[model samples]
Target chain A: MDIKNILISVDASDNAMRAVDYAASILANAEGVRVTLLYIERAPNRDKFDDEAAWLNQCKLDHDRVFDFLKTARQKLVAAGLPEASVHERTVLCSAEPSIAQTILDVQQAEGFGTLVVGRRGLTKGEEFLFGSVSSKLVHNAKNCAVWVVQ
Target chain B: MPESVRELVERFKPPVSVRTYGTVFTDTTEFMNIGYGDVIKLGGRYYLVLGDERERRFGMEDPKFWVKRCVEMESGQYRILKLEFQESFDQHIGSLTITCHRSAAKEARILRLVAGDMRFMQGLGVRDERGNLARVLERVAGRRLDLNIEDLHQSHREYFQETFPGILQRFIGACRAIHHLHQHGETHGDIRRDHLYVDHKTGEYCWIDFDYGYDSVENPFGLDLFGLGNILSFITGKGVHTIQDVDAEALGITEADCALFFRHRVVNLRKLFPYIPADLNNVLMHYSAQSEVFYESVPELLADLEPCLENLRRA
Candidate 1:
């Protein structure tokens, strides 16, 4: 119940947005709760057809989009009465690593968040295997934080 | 005549013929011969199992086993049974005497009316109806469909190939059914393949069995979602080896003995038939992903599945 730091990872999908809403709701109740919005950049060369330069440019565009998404998410939290200073944003530039699960785990540990909120789907696995999600890696690899996957 | 056995038999009308065997009696009704007294076979169709008289006196229950035999009756054959008593010396063998009667067509009809009511069929349809659908689902690529987790190992190698194509659509239907249940504030506690019935004509899936179901504010969608994922692994014969292989592990119990059990569970659908399609793989994956998000309820999962189903249909 003593939630000190909360980490919300977003992929800009509707599901991820739901996670943001959930994080905001939890943060809304806790006193002095700090929220960190993190987005891991998808690696290049994963798309079979895209060339290196094209992938890099797309990554930049994706970065800007992430920034915009975080900005909007932060404002929504503020409007919902969370202190603006308590909210922070960070982005890691990594190749579209199949190890997003590992990256999420690493970030959660490094930041020492009590709770980690994530969308049901992100960069982990494809859409087909949605329910019995392969998202286990993220939950399994997390050291101490309780991971809440927003569907 | 022992008072107990005589009284037990008197509870029902006298059989056309009664014969004693080891510890049972055979009672012949008009159309069928029921084995009563002990355990007997009458006209090869009915079996009456008796309880020990001592056990009955002590308020212990009798053995309750009813055997129904399918036989062709001749026009003039009278029902007859051969009975046996467990202890020949005991005057009153058991507290309960089982009367076996050949159920006449009229009796069978009455029983059907009482037992085969729509509600009962619906209940049975919910539990065992999946078998009927599994039979109709065409075998894909010379491989059979493993309908449950018990069939994993024997069907594993061909699982991925057999499930990829048709899986998405099946998932869409499942999601829809789950969504409907959630909307009504009900949770399908058991979402196993055996609980699902696939329409033979339309390939549409219907969820059967409302028994053990729950309706609560804290909906355990995750549990049901995981059950769905478990079914996918079962149907695909992958057998849920790792979290990567299954969605049920999302509950956070990673190194427990239960996890190990999941890893070794075996189901063998391929051995039965060899033509299951490969399209079901996609469906398995879709359901697995949805399982992760089950806490959000079934409607959200169905929304995610709708487009996936459309894509599969287009393909």
Candidate 2:
């Protein structure tokens, strides 16, 4: 019941920023509370023109973008009064083999975080039907850890 | 057995025991409250008795004026009639009444063409002398489908698939009705999925609402066709639900992407549904296309749609 560790999944989206803001507001001055910002690089599916080099280049670009997003998120938390020492950043390249959702859950289990903070990109009913969302998957799958999905 | 005149007359008189007709509309939350009306039955036929005495001093000048005018000007079965509430104080508190006619398949076709009953609720609409309005809708004896498109798509997906041929037929029927409007030098300016109605029993489609319609416009039927495109996409996609729900960011459909549509760069529906028929996707693309390269006339659109519908029906 004690708030100790919080893992937030960051993306280059307003919703992701909103999640960070939510975590910062709730855990701003809480004693011993630590924040881990996790950025997952979902492996891009290859098309006809996309060779190994092109795929790697795209990954590198995505990594840099996500890295920058993570840095901004950390700065936001520190500014909100959480100690810089309490904030941590983690990144991983999730191959399509395990699925993006499974990768997220795997990391959550390994780290043993108490709470997972994730942003919900509002998908349409049709979109949701075709592709089940990551936040939804985590909430349903992660039974032990508390998952807060900020829209 | 039909009721006698004496029985019908007695039914309309005093105690106002018309409760068994349909139901008194106490819940006006979902209803359009222009005036109060009781859905009553007489002589085995249904009638709506709409009453307003608020403007009695001013000659009860609303539906009474329009009803009187319509009776004088238009011939045949008058949709409005003067209801005498003998016990009521006012000498001339008139009720606009409409007789409900059971529309057969043949009648539904003619109704769609002549009545413009597609957009509005199927009913007899009466406006006051000052142009205020009230409607006495026909009692639909058959099942009424869900009002919202989202619910219809979600709940009736199987129905749509099973009766897709018939659905396509109705789609063409709507297009034909639009064609009729265009032929008369009129335009249904605001054409959307909401304006189109489908009869659950008859599978008939009607176009309603001419509030935004006009006798003539600068653009020759293009906007209506564009609206038809929107309707087609709505049917194919089941329903998009809301504009905000659109994957605008993912589909690159922002203001920057607006130019792509204008440049004849088509957005495939198959991208949303990979197994979607190519013919159906092509029809969708053609309708959603900005240029006249696809269709300039309703007939042209129909020409394309008929074959597509046939092919889809066969498939």
Candidate 3:
């Protein structure tokens, strides 16, 4: 598959770093491919703010913090042989509008990303039972796109 | 106590009840009369009802929903039970509700991490068979200090001034909370004055409504610092409430402006509040000003703010 855009979800967790490393190694020779790093955050409480203006101010803050992570991802991708300019980063705060996996699928479709990459942290059966894994959810939901679960 | 007798005894025991809270709807159009203290039962599990009129809803019936649901359930790694759209409403104009697994909320992780040092409104997550999700949050008990309401702004300013030291302490406490999140390699994503809540009597405070995502941006810390600056400005009556309140021309900006240039023009903190104290003013300007030397991290900004807070303590 000629991967035009590869969207990877990362966090501070070690699994996310593993996924980053995996993507770097796999895409080392894949020229002309663009990589996008995405991080999804929990959405803010809308009821707390009395109006849209207050909510907008909070949104600005959320968007502002993404700059640092984007820069770091760009550096890693560039060091991994991806063109610096071709690597892009974005962040989304889930307001419970859509489940996290669905949100990722929507972004993939909207942005025309050809592949989705995520880390598969081996969760204990109990851990999985309590907190559903985002990777497994993405792998099943993605249509017409490649889903990569890096362990 | 023999093995065979013990096995027989265990097998005869009643099934454990899976705890559930609230109702699950298929879409926003489903009619909902859900409220706090309501209970929902599915597959021998009972979920306590929670949410107000303004509670956020979650649901989906997309094609991929089936696939995602299957994957999530098949993994044998989740506590989410089998979900189904038990009823369909005639009209779909309103929001859809889902039964959230209590442990599904990100706040649960936060609560565990903070160990009750900071309080947050708790909630449960509701997920359906299609992998749709929603949360059931416990309402934080207190009158909301809605400073953003135009009618309340003046009154709030008076209240803030009357309790300046307390308000300042609360603001610092909030910063400390944000700093804690940063230490764990996380960002609140959305930081503002609205998220801070205080008990009317005790004056104990907590930052509510964790939102926002982390990304690889040029200045990762700039976002929160900018937010903290704006929040401090607002609490201190130094912030402009609206865009029109700002004088774009003073910054040598034009009417027709792009985002980058406009942001630069808008961050004129000195112009907005020239009389602001030098130390706090410096911190605010550096963080809020788009073109100025912004602090690279939250700790660095806190370094400057701590001294200003100490000065306040002495005064």
Top-lDDT candidate index: 2
**Model 3, range B43-137, lDDT digits (tens) per residue?**
22333322223322123322211111110211112122222222212211112121221112344345445654644544344543334334333
**Cα lDDT of model 2 by residue, B1-315, tens digit:** 124423443344335443323343222222233232343232224334334322122234433321111111111122332221111111110121112111122122333446544423354433323332333334232222224345553444464456556667777888888887777654565676756766656667756434332211113465577668767766666654232455755754433222113322224555545555777766666643232234546898787778877776776
Each model's total of backbone clashes: 75, 9, 33
lDDT of 2 at B173: 81
Which has the higher DockQ value, candidate number 1 or candidate number 3?
3
Instruction: Order the candidates by lDDT, highest first.
Output: 2, 3, 1
Weakest ten-residue segment in model 3 chain B by summed lDDT: B64-73
The TM-scores, one per candidate, come to 0.33, 0.39, 0.43
- Candidate 3 regions exceeding 4 Å error are A1-151, B1-38, B41-105, B123-136, B145-162, B214-219, B238-243, B246-275, B288-290, B313-315
Error of 1 at B244 (Å): 31
Q: For candidate 1 chain A, which ten residues in a row score worst on lDDT?
A: A125-134
Candidate structures ordered by DockQ, highest first: 3, 1, 2
- Sort the candidates on TM-score, descending order: 3, 2, 1
Candidate 2, fnat value?
Answer: 0.00
Judge candidate 3 at residue A71 and give its lDDT.
65
Q: Which one is best on DockQ? A: 3
lDDT of 1 by residue, B1-315 (tens): 345444444443234454433243333222123333443323332223332111121346554122222111222222221112111121110121212112122122222332422211121111011111000011111112234324445444454444544654665566666665545434454565555655545555555433232211112354566566566555444433444433434434232212111433322222222343333333333333222323245565555545554554464
Q: Can you give the lDDT of residue A77 in candidate 1?
A: 83
Chain B structural similarity (TM-score) per candidate: 0.37, 0.52, 0.56
Instruction: Report how far residue B190 has shifted in candidate 2, in Å.
Output: 3.3
